[model samples]
Target: MLALASFISKHHPTLPITLISTADAASTPPSVTYRRLPDLAPPQPPIKNPVESFFETHRLHKPNLRAALVEISEKSRIAALVLDIFCNAAFHVSAALGIPTDFYVSNGSPGAAVFLNFPTMDETLDVDIGDMNDYLHFPGFPAIHSTPSKTVVFLCFGRRGLHSAEQLKETAVALERSGHRFLWSVRNPPGKGGDVPNLEEILPEGFLERTKEKGFVVRSWAPQSEVLSHEAVAGFVTHCGRSSVMEAVSSGVAMIAWPIDAKQKMNKVFLVEEMKAALPLDTGEGGLVTADELERRVRELMDATTGRAIRHRVAEMKASAAAAVGENGSSVLALHKFINDCCGRADG
Candidate 1:
């Protein structure tokens, strides 16, 4: 979101952009108008036990968001409203105000975007998402085939403590056993006291020293876009978050799908089955992925011939992604149309 907003602010300074998020004043960028919203779905309190907390928070935001929209519209000549796909409640507000609303999926994958529009597409095609062997087809893209060694980047889990301590420990053990060079972004568990936990206490003893030469574990936060853009990084072990998936694709990196929550599982399906841009890890049994299995999968992705093919396909998609956002690109043309349609001019 920041990247897109920054680009617009830099290229079209006259156009105003307002960002409605739970981010605080310090975190919000100066390029955009930031409306402070209560973070009902905070990272603390471990939002795992009762999944309703997440939904309830979104429901709670409806009234406040509606008021904010109405207030903003009254202050300015609103052209159009762009919203995250999950912000369905806000759609009603836009409709009530007779304003046009555009849903931003934020993944930037044409294949994934098309998959989301499947309902509007021909309903005759029977694409079995459960079958990895089945070829899922989309318009404007070549047939996606399974490939075999792409360098792997592993993200332990999402921000909301979806994984248990045992699962995290198992992930650490797998990374060690894989013997592959990696960058792991590790975060403190939800509900933990103020201080960040020591790496020794969290990971296996001697784990850091053993992998010091090849692996880097970043506690709290890591510059994900920078890390993924590195030439050495070829694939991602991710939770299938939209932004992360788009970043991986834009950087020509393949994936090992390990979706943890929400629409992530659906995104994983798009990457693994629809787009064939990823390999899926099985966590259905016991919910604990053994070190041996992790090592095998890592080796297959990093050292196998099939991994090379996957990397090649991902490179092609990277070119497509770049072209889509380039001058006179599909996304560029769409933006122009949207501006002209909403504001009655392309200058806005």
Candidate 2:
């Protein structure tokens, strides 16, 4: 959401954006002022259903959000009130305030598709969600400095994917055994949020020294898109977050998809089965990939015939993505049409 606000502010400076979010973002642009809503209390009885829990939590914030919107609008006109895709509760509030509402789905079209179609799926499918396997519908370019590209695998789990110490050890050992160059971004495990990981404690002893020549571990975070576009990165071991998937596709880097969440699982199916641009990473108990399994998968991604096909497919996608964003391309034209349509409506 911050990214979108920043983009609009940069491109359309005349339109000042007042952002409403739960927390303060880092390095927020001056053009967009934050109108934060106080955090809501945790759902009572802890709703078991994620969908119900999500909506209920947001619904509780309607009063405060309404008050804020009303207050903000009194000072200046709100062109549109954009809600997070899950925050449908805000629609009524926005409507009452006579503010046009739009839902922002930060994750790309694949996530959006599954979310928008979920209602139909729930109504149609007789089987439980876990048992129903048949339907998974799925659908960033950074500048590069001139450097010779080499063969290196890039590994990054998304922000929400904090691996256990044992998982980290297995991943490190696997990268070492694979005998391939790699860049791994490691973070503190769950519950140790915000603390920088002590790499020495999380990984096997002497692992870094052994693989110093072939591997590098980035603590906390990595510049993923830039790294993916680097000449050395041949494949990505990803958690299949929508942004990561899009970046991989745009960079033409094939993947070893190991999804960490439900949304990502949907993306994995699309990448592995539908797009044929990635191979699935098999996880065992506790969702940990053993050293041998990880090593084999890495080798398969880098050297096998299937790996060749995956790479070829993603490379083609890269070309398609470039064309879509180019002058008068599909995305460009669609964006223009949307802008014109919105302007026409506003005029009326």
Assess each prediction's global lDDT (C-alpha) against the native.
0.71, 0.82
lDDT by residue for model 2 over 1-348, one digit each (tens)? 889999999999878888886676557688888877887766367789998887887888898899899888889998898888888888999999889989989898656766676678556433344223111222211222123463789999977788887888889889998898899999998766565888887799999899899889898899999999886788899999999999999988889999989999999999999999899878898788899889988998877343657776787899999999999999999999999999999999
Candidate with the greatest lDDT versus the true structure: 2
Q: RMSD in Å for candidate 1, one decimal?
A: 24.9
Task: List candidate 2 segments past 4 Å from native.
Answer: 1-148
Query: What TM-scores do the predictions have?
Result: 0.54, 0.56
* Structure candidate 2, residue pairs in collision: 149-231, 150-231, 150-232
Count the clashes in each prediction.
Answer: 7, 3
Residue 49 miss distance in model 2 (angstroms): 67
lDDT of 1 by residue, 3-44 (tens): 666777888887888888756753434667878776654454
